[model samples]
Target: MMASRATARATGSFAAYTVSELTSLIRASLESAFGTIWVEGEISNFRLAPSGHTYLTLKDEVSGIRAVVFRGVGKRLGFCLENGLRVVCRGRLTVYEPRGDYQIIIDALEPKGIGARQLALEQLKARLADEGLFDTARKRALPSFPQQIGVVTSIAGAVVWDIIKVVHRRFPLADILIFPVTVQGQLAGRDIARMIRELNTQRTSDVLIVARGGGSAEDLRAFNEEQVARAIYQSRVPVISAVGHEIDYTVADLVADYRASTPSAAAEAATPALTELVNRLQSNHTRLAHSFSRLLQQWWAKVEALNVAGLDPQAVLQRYLQRVDELETRIGVCVMRNIDRVKEHVLGLCQGLGYCGPTKHTVRLVERVSHLTLRQDKQIVSFLETKSRAVESAGARLHALSPLAVLERGYAIARHWPSLKLLRAATDARVHDRVQLQLFNGCLLCKVQEVQQ
Candidate 1:
């Protein structure tokens, strides 16, 4: 048996593999065996690198495995990755060469308990709410009278027609201007936001109505996007959001100035009923007319009573004249009293002026000026002394910091000749090379005999 084993070895039948080759073989085996698989586990040791790659460990109760999601796949993920999150992943198994360990290269991932889109929506809603975008204080009141109503919706959809019809029925005099946009699919959110901004820039509409027909959550995603919500929040023109049915609400609805149940409701809210306003105005006009007529009739009745009672016109005129004479006498007495009081006030002011004559004032000002001059002279001298001391201190400090002071302490600096480059080490100059030495008084030219290091 020993002879036969030796013969087999001598025939070159033995096989061996390097570390890289073995790892490649193991990777092939793992990929072939597992193919594409779905794994459910809790994430642990989650890390996000600056390069946008995600690294985490997927662990169950019994075991754990390393996983990596490259930038391309990670960018498409709807929700943030975090430790302790329960998730389900789809990928294939492979062997990592440097670590010689098995791992999963993730292609897809989602939270196990909720749908990815829903989770993303909830997270975004919370973030925007924290930024006060959903505050009721930021909401605006719809214009009571919007002459030009701006409608943002899909032109092909029935929503635009519903808004136009409602506006026409309630307030026919108001003009309708439609800003067409896609209400579904990928470009819907961006298109809606862009139209809102453009309408604001134009300033042609008093109020804006952003509406779409009722649809599923997925179909209504355009209204839930952050871009649409921010646009509604920042709109100068008050926005009435009517995205879906009464039971449905979106981010746009929260951020809009007013949330309407439907497209028709939004249009109705934006405009006032012309007939009602006209009726109110007519009622007010009739009431005012009645009040004026009543006033005129009351005056006429007083005159008629006077005539019925046979009041003498000559006697009434004499009585009025006597009253006027008495009023004139009282007004004359009051005028004399006012004139006496004003004369007394003038006398008091004259006495006050005599007490504070200009000569005394000028003397007081001269004394103040002399005092200020003396104080200013003393302050100038003190200031000069302080500045002189500071300058001397600064000069001393500068002299200590000067390189010539170090040279006076017997330290010399060497440099390569001609180039004047500083030589910090012996290796800087080779044997027989020219060098210059800087000293306290002068520089010395020399030749490098040897280099120690």
Candidate 2:
């Protein structure tokens, strides 16, 4: 027995298994050990591959484990997977043979509670709203005819393509300029702010859109940053916040000039519908033509109703006949009245001549006698002297009362310049005046040089 034991020990070795067999054994062991285990931890090292596979590390204070969800499982999750989010994941355990590392094949994940990113977004939105940045009254109206549209979004996102499509379809003439930016991850908020400032500096766009595709609250945290909110508030051009899904809102949305539910909606808001406008214009044209035609028809009917030539001949003949009758009657009455007046006037004239003939004859004889006497007695000097003395007395009285006589008596008269009234004293002088100086011989017009106090 001792010899047999020695020989067996020399030949004995552990049974070797193939790689696939070993991996399957390990996987079965792990599945049995942690079958459908639920783990609650903070997410870390999250990664999404081009193949639609998500890889991440879930950690707690005690331990952490690597985990992955294939495309089929990942697509079922309602919310985004992000770092530092508290989440509960259910999965089966398995071992990767090539790497010989144990991993959880996650079947499902749900928020353990509200995540930090979500809380941060909510707090920011509340603070901004309290400061009245979100007030509807402060919102600016979007331009109906925007010459250019500015977009602030990720350079590599599908949002830009969606916006371009909608805008091109609605208003092909509208000019669009994209301000490329990071819409997710760290420094995304800063990048968004910088893009907004740069667009403001250029001042080339009439309207600005801050847009991105729909994502979870954590994924859209950049839009809730204070820098992004302030940039939107301070923008001169009207800003449209089109950040996430319809139900998701951020501080950027509250502070923007307008808010659109999606990027496509933002494009629609910024542009006019060409097809609808063309249809409206055609409708108006048809209405205008119809109105004009109706008006022409009414005018033509009015013209046709009137008989211009048919009424003219009868109306003219009636007027002329009536005028001729009135003129004949007036002429006969005027002739009769004139004959009576002429007879009366002639009789009155004869009576007046007869009555004044005696006075006329006496005046004529007296005038003839006076002329003959005056001619015969040319040297009646005493009567002529008396008449001349009376005339001289009257002339002297008139000259003493006259203003010109007063001026001519060696007493100077000063007159107010504009009113032409005589100035009694120096006090009557004003600063602006053309004074008239009345001398004994003549008057002199002079401007006021100065006035004595």
Candidate 3:
């Protein structure tokens, strides 16, 4: 009995020591596993919650792992988080206390190779800059008063309407042409490029604006495509790019002749306020009138002075003649003092028609009248000539801008007969429908006898 009790006591002591050692080892292992690790992957399933926490999945070619960057760490990240972006993340592996599952708690993140989109943008910018596409010298100045503005954008999008409204508000005289095209998805870039080329070839517009409203990176990707950028660079007409919000930048923006912060801004840049221009013109007219009036007054003063000086020349001649007559009379008075001197002098004056002669004054009055009449006639002729030239020049300019000029240049305008609106396509007229054909000389009204397939 004594030997069995001693064995039982020894077994209990050994069991307690084993349990304590295992517990210590497990604690140490947990500590080692929870330390920091570096991971590289493309971002996916990114979510930023209202609670200021971010959750995302990082995946490589084979596997993905869940990660969370609390509000504190997320706030420290300078760039925006987006899916498909390759990045390197620094974080620690930890088990969620509630679910008891391991996840990465990201403390920091940096773009892997500067991010794909950013790298592509930088490379394109460099290439275009080298080709002088982005050179300020190559950029065409926006028209101060564009008569016809063409817009290239999606037909269904609000951006087109926004541009129209803004342009109308700023310059009602400007004619707007909407060139509808796809602005998103796979074929959007090609559609835009095609429209730009067509407008350039036709010379249908004074200026072209490629525009779209703001959206996420993917939604705005069509504007960043190289094809669209090349189209903008190759355009014969000046192009204005209005792709997104003020902070956003795209390849089209860099290649375009001008960049506007938004669609409305693009419209504003394309045209000017008619009302403000009118006000400025009125102000200038008033200033010109004031300046002309001052000049006229100065000229009138000079003319009046010349007329007074011419009139006084006769008075100067009269004074000199009077002095000579007085000297002769004084010399004669000493020789024949009382031999009827007063009577003889009176007879001589009567024969000479007096010192201030009516004949000379009459001649001066006639000359002055003739001079004034000649000046008035000259002024009238000059004014009429100036007005006639101005009218002729204005008529020539208006004729040049007339739509009929296009028809005169070997072009025909097809219009719907009933509505008299220009027909853009042959489908606008039916097989039996009548249509109006406007040629250079005259209009021809024709009824379709047969439809051609």
Candidate 4:
């Protein structure tokens, strides 16, 4: 205490300044002297506090100064503060009373040579790319005919109207649902990401279109945000990104399943043209009808070429008649041969009796032979009558078994027209089908106007 007073006396003061008092005076002087000045330096030892304040060291070759980005200001900065990045920041010098040190309280900051938003977009793209969010294999195919399309964009903007107009013009059958969200400013990214997650949860749409009008990078900053990109990546529904013009590319564009040059183009891609679809259906129907007609014509031709005589009952009956005639002729020949043999044997027996002279014994022998001849003739006539009766009976049975007999009884056989398959029941022939009726004489082709159960 005595040495402190001695130092105070040597400096010509009644009392020494406390640490807090000195720090306060320095803070007031430094802040007043360099109020909102721009400084260009490379960032070092960059760290973010739990309170959202960023603490970093800004330095050149021979000098270094402490810098702090308050939460409010950091939120507005478009890029991340990283080590080794040369930046030009606008801020006022402020002394930290507790630490007895000074730092620049940054209000705005930018990269030394490039825009902050661009650099941030590039950085985020690289990060998400490393995680495979931008892989072509992970991309999904858009539904060719989406029934319902979910649109995430600003309701007040013209982009949404353009999409609605184009989609309705091309495919009036598709329905459009609008999800309103901010498309610019600091909170825009958060709003977009929230809506995307909500849309995925409900899954009401077949496909989604996240779009915005053409603008500068700052205006379209929401789409480049990491959260927005991730929300699109995780969406179950396929996403089509239509942000800015064709020349402008954002992180959302890279991560989406499809990218369109404009909102109108996105709508065109999401749905098919109504006229084209109708024409395609009509063409297919015509082709199917022609094919069916050609097949029916071919079947009809085959039926016409079929030989009806092969199924004729007269031909079958003629074969049976020829067989009967052959059997009758064979029986007649065998009967005549047996009669000749019997006559020869009777003559030989008469010669062996030695009746050469004209005597009573010879006359008696002649009488006996005459009696035997009459008896043999009676037996032959009975046998011939029995054989004729048997032949007639066989012919009657053969005629009874023939199909012509059934047809003659007024029973007709029905067969399918083209296929020639026999129809047993009424259901075998469909209504409006042609059928063939086989009668006793010939086949009759008739059309079945109706079918009975």
Among these predicted structures, which one has the highest TM-score?
1
**lDDT of every model, 2 decimals:** 0.92, 0.86, 0.86, 0.91
Tell me the tens digit of each residue's lDDT in model 3 across 217-320: 88898988778988988898999999989998988988899999999999999999988999999999999999999999999887778677776655767999
Q: List the residue pairs that clash in candidate 1.
A: none
Q: lDDT by residue for model 2 over 12-71, one digit each (tens)?
A: 933455777767878888888878898889899999999999999999998999999899
Best by lDDT: 1
lDDT of 3 at 369: 100
Cα lDDT of model 4 by residue, 145-233, tens digit? 89999999999979999999999888998889999999999899999999999989988899999999999877887888889998999
lDDT agreement of model 3 with the native:
0.86
- Candidate 2: lDDT of 229? 90
lDDT over C-alpha atoms for residue 59 of model 3: 97
Give the TM-score ranking, best first: 1, 4, 3, 2
**Candidate 2 ranges with C-alpha deviation above 4 Å:** 1-119, 308-453
**Ranked by lDDT, top first:** 1, 4, 2, 3
lDDT of 1 by residue, 1-453 (tens): 446656778998764567887788889899999999999999999999999899999999999999999999988997778898899999999988898999999999999989989988998899999999999997877888878999999999888988888898889988998999999999999999999999999999999999999999999999999999999888999999998999999999998889999999998899898889999999999999999999999998987887789986668889999999999999999999999999999999999989876988899999999999999999999999999999999999999999999999999999999899999989889999999999999999999887886
In the order shown, the candidates' Cα RMSDs to the true structure are 7.8, 36.0, 32.0, 40.5
Structural similarity to truth (TM-score) of each candidate? 0.65, 0.43, 0.45, 0.53
